[model samples]
Target chain A: MEQKKLITYTAGHASVRKQLLLFWTFFIIGSFTIGGGYAMILMMKRYLVEQYHWLKDEEFYDMLAISQVTPGPIAVNMATFVGYTQGGVLGSVLATLGVSIPAVAVIIVIAVFFPGFKDNVWIQRFFAGVIVGVVAQIATIVLDMGKRQKWTTISVIVCAGSLGVLFFVQQVSPIWLILGGGLVGLAVEALKPKSAGGASS
Target chain B: MSFLALFGVFFKIGIFTFGGGQAMIPLLQKDLVVNLAWVSMKEFLDFVAISEITPGPVAINMATFVGYKLRGLTGALVTSLGVILPSFIIILIVATVAHTFRTNLWVSAFLDGLQPVVLALLTYAVYSIAMGGIPAWWGYVAALGILLLILKYGKRLNLFLVLLAAGGLGLLMFR
Candidate 1:
């Protein structure tokens, strides 16, 4: 009876250990993914694209485009994709947790100190500066996506026209632009088969 | 609803938000705003705006804000966790299965083809997002200049500062 009980306990411990090991390995893998639209993307840019070389320049650019185009936060999706590609289910969990860990911790701290710095002039000033950085960061990703995608002439025209329409016609929904642009893209491909490889067909 | 129920809603958000958080918009509008009547459209709009302007994941922000609105801090916690749970679960399952097919050429080719379409979508998204906030020609100029700066340098400028300034300026001038 004693031996059986010991064996059961040891088995439970071993299984738990295996699960945790899997989780941690993925977490390490997750740490490498550079998320789209994330503050960490900026902070880790050098390490990822520059130092680590986990994502090639072109691949990084493509990843940026995919993440942004998809309906979710570009960062999370990008992270998940990388994690999944590299480590599978365990990898994804690790990546998601690794990326989220920082944000979650920060939020918890902020919440704990609810309105902690609301009236502090200096904190406000610092945060305002962070906003400029964030905007610059956003601009960086957008440009990176454009350069990486290597827009065709039709795409350029579509972009310019859409820019105008969106700017001038505030009432027009952005969704319309996305749908119309896609349809126009199909039309352009159909018309200019030689130029763009005509992928639509 | 209880905190657990709120978590369940977020879990649903995470699971079916297929494309990502923006995809969650209509679902969120339908379920949270319409069916549940958890909050008003105006408030929902406010949440959307906050999501865009915040630093982390937009969906996470929306979940946090909405949760807070419905059930205070605890509600916020449950909803935020819930919204991300599906992605975690799905990705885990998908990742495990992905190993067998990662090297398949057809899949690779399909992904390659999807790249350009994704780029098209992103280009469209950027134009849509940037064009709205500023009206004056100078405002456009600032945006363009910002774009150029980002391309030339990097994300060195602080984000929070810019928003407060923009909001303050907007309040001062427009309001």
Candidate 2:
């Protein structure tokens, strides 16, 4: 009877081991990802939900939604929020720090050295190519978003109008476009009939 | 720049930016490149490329790189802290009340409106960055080829490898 009780306790309540696992998991994810924030979503879902079963699919997605709605980088938000859920404040800190290690170390190295060699012709050529790759990646993201959107008249107008405004008025900050969109959305929602019952598609 | 001013700028950027790291690009370009002349547009593109190549959040990477450029190691630390603090504090609050927050009508409505605008801004970023980054005719061809490969292969093709390959190609082409 005592042996059975011991086995169960060891299996279920190894807090330190769980914390280490959490830290390591985030560290691995952080290390591998190239694009920041939005790019990490798939890996997060795969590791956190499918592999470890730390969160349900719905739960992972909910966190994603919340991350998007809130400020700061989505990657940081996910690390902090998911860490909190799994291991409290300590877990959050460890996970955040784990994820941050690569960015800090790598950027510091480049910051120290890259500027000194900025004028090198070969290095400049390599970066010029890399920027092409970056542009292609952004193009992919734009394509993906375009496919996902449900283009209504209002949404089309809003999108095209903002693009045109930005094109013409180079000095107009994007802050205004985002804020204006929100206010317009709020006003539309308020004007809707009570019987409408749900958000407009 | 002084540490306090650096921290202050990043902190404001951290709080003001919504959507994610990509969304912060326009603001960063406006503030850092256009207004302050801290880094030129060419250098800013370099930063973006570096951020994409490195691990962790792009926002954090940008903070560190820009900070280090301006003020060395301490600047990097301060800017990172500035960008991170808002998300950390905000998430703690939201995590406790996620259900309520998700169900809030006003929030959903606001996001719905913001969505289209965010798309426009992202598109603008692509345009602006591409204009400056891709000067040669072959560069555009390279970009198009890469875009096709990514679209066709999807996630099966790793981006890091693709970038490294492009660098190799750049060496040969530009030579």
Candidate 3:
């Protein structure tokens, strides 16, 4: 008949200090990560998985997979996933806020100080150089993903087919390609022998 | 544009666009620059460059930059919230369901299907950026150099250092 105390029930959970630490970790990673979400993946792995041991390597990959399949930036998705898994919804909110703060501050400053920033030759040259690095970063991601696949004949065909569609077609949306690839995968999966089908990776 | 309109447009951009930051460019161009005229073409280009060089997702950075341009700080906050809100909600839902469906056949198949398509998208990202960014011979050389450096060093090398080295190379060669 008596109401249980909420504080006592939640006592074993992470303290606010630990939550704040989670926030700061994401904030620092967000502040330092340049290029884009793909680049952020590598950083997240290094800091969250490798350095801190907050997440297991398999769990991190699973989150990365979910981040890709779902909509939104990988960085944001990752932050939300990590936070939720670690500290629940509050963790999610805090992590997202932390990751966003640095970008907001930097952009605001740039907007104020550099109204005519685009015309600056030095900035242009700097980006022209950074663009190369960004491309390489994406390339590295592609290689990393490619290496992860089990590489069956069906997968090889799917990879080539998707690449051809993307390369040759002018106006096909990636969303459609993604959906089609899913169908192809479903069909391939359905047709495989039961014994072989047991090995889903 | 009104605050509501700004939020609406960015929210739409957030949900509909896939393949991450670079993939949002044409959509942003069409909706914000061409249709609404909230941002100019030149400003959009500059925003793209700034977003790339800055420390967050391009989509979020663009949202903040444009939001500030339109309505100062409130605009920045509102637009960023708009852009990230969809992903946040979607990911929250997916994360919730993912554990329950971790071993489902259809789910695994769908994810497996996504693997190649994701690869294609990444490859396309590399191709598109290279087409636009690497116009000269030196640009190609620089790209090749960075790729080799990453391959050799793997994760041992810090990306920031690689970027800084590329910037230095750009200053010397591009100039």
- Point out where model 3 deviates above 4 Å: A1-18, A55-58, A195-201
**Which of the CAPRI classes, incorrect, acceptable, medium or high, describes model 1?**
incorrect
What fraction of the native interface does candidate 3 get right in terms of contacts? Answer: 0.63
Considering every candidate listed, which one attains the maximal lDDT?
Answer: 3
- lDDT for model 2 comes to 0.74
**What lDDT score belongs to each candidate, Candidate 1 first?**
0.52, 0.74, 0.77
lDDT by residue for model 3 (B122-169), tens: 788788877877646778777888888888987688877877778777
- Candidate 2 error regions (>4 Å): A1-95, A111-115, A196-201, B1-13, B16-75
Model 1 chain B: weakest 10-residue lDDT segment is B100-109
Candidate 2 has a TM-score of 0.70
What local lDDT does model 1 show for residue B96?
45
TM-score of each: 0.62, 0.70, 0.86
Give model 2's TM-score for chain A to 2 decimal places: 0.59
Runs in model 1 lying further than 4 Å from the true structure: A1-47, A58-72, A83-91, A101-139, A150-201, B100-102, B154-175
Location of the lowest summed lDDT over 10 successive residues in candidate 3 chain B: B95-104
Candidate DockQ values, in order, are 0.16, 0.45, 0.51
lDDT of 3 at A180: 83
Q: State the lDDT of candidate 2 residue by residue for A1-201, as single tens digits.
A: 111111000012228877788788888767766556654655576578767887775456446655766788888888888887877777777778777777788889877766554456776677667667767776776676677665877778888999999899887666688778778778877986766334422
- Poorest lDDT segment (10 consecutive residues) of candidate 2 chain B: B95-104
